[model samples]
Target: MNLLLARGANVSDQDGSGTPALHRATHARHKAMVSFLPENAANVEEKDEDSCTALTIAVKGKFEAGIKLLLSKGCPVNFSYKPRVSNTVSCT
Candidate 1:
């Protein structure tokens, strides 16, 4: 991942769902990647299509490490996301 980033990978690039690497790393419980992203200029404020931030994904999934990492980095806690789709939100 570092190699890709070093090669100019767009850290802020989003998928079809507007999910960036930060969101994916947080949701996957990848604390290191999560930390690396924002440090490398990935937007801490980027939200997915559901209006959920990395912090929101961490909290919803009960990913303790991801939560602590994000919070310590000054991510917002007052977000209130409302998903546009009816897909089930995975909490694990």
Candidate 2:
């Protein structure tokens, strides 16, 4: 990765689907890869084609270590791609 970076590759470069390097790292359960990412890895926060952030995948995958690593790197806990909707209906 260092060589790639030196060759002008962006550490935050996402795939055509916007899945960043950190997302792949989490999926592969690569602890070392997590550390290698910039300290501000969370800044990428680019969602995949499914609109799922790395944090969301880590949480759902039950990758406790990866989740903690992302959190420590500044990933927001309450990040959501879509706004929440209230169940209450308006009274006419």
Candidate 3:
């Protein structure tokens, strides 16, 4: 990953679902990758197709380490998500 970043890969690039590598790493529970991506400029607030951020994903997945890392990096504590409903739910 370092080598790719050094070669100028876009750290913020997203897939068709608007899921960035950072979110994928978090979903997969890759602690080292999760920690490393942020340092390389990954956006912690980036949301996926479901409007879920990496922090939310981590929390939903019950990944304590991932949640801690995101929080420590200053990922917003009040992220908002509106599922298919008309109401917005807050993930803290």
Model 3 collision count: 0
RMSD of each: 4.0, 7.4, 3.7
Ranking by lDDT: 3, 1, 2
TM-score of candidate 2 versus the correct structure, residues matched by position: 0.70
Which pairs in model 1 have colliding backbones? none
Candidate 1, 1-92: lDDT as tens digits: 88997798998988776789899999889888988888888888777886778998887788999888888877888776454366435221
Give the poorly placed runs of model 2, Cα more than 4 Å off: 40-44, 79-92
CA lDDT, every prediction? 0.81, 0.68, 0.82
Q: After superposition, how far is residue 28 of candidate 2 from its true place, in Å?
A: 1.2
lDDT of 2 by residue, 1-92 (tens): 67867787776777776778878888888877776784634353566666666677677667899888878777666654342365221211
- Per-candidate TM equals 0.82, 0.70, 0.81
Mark the regions of model 3 whose C-alpha exceeds 4 Å error after superposition. 80-92
Pairs in steric clash, model 2 = none
Positional deviation of residue 11's Cα in model 3 after best superposition, in angstroms: 1.2
Report the error of model 3 at residue 38, Å.
1.0
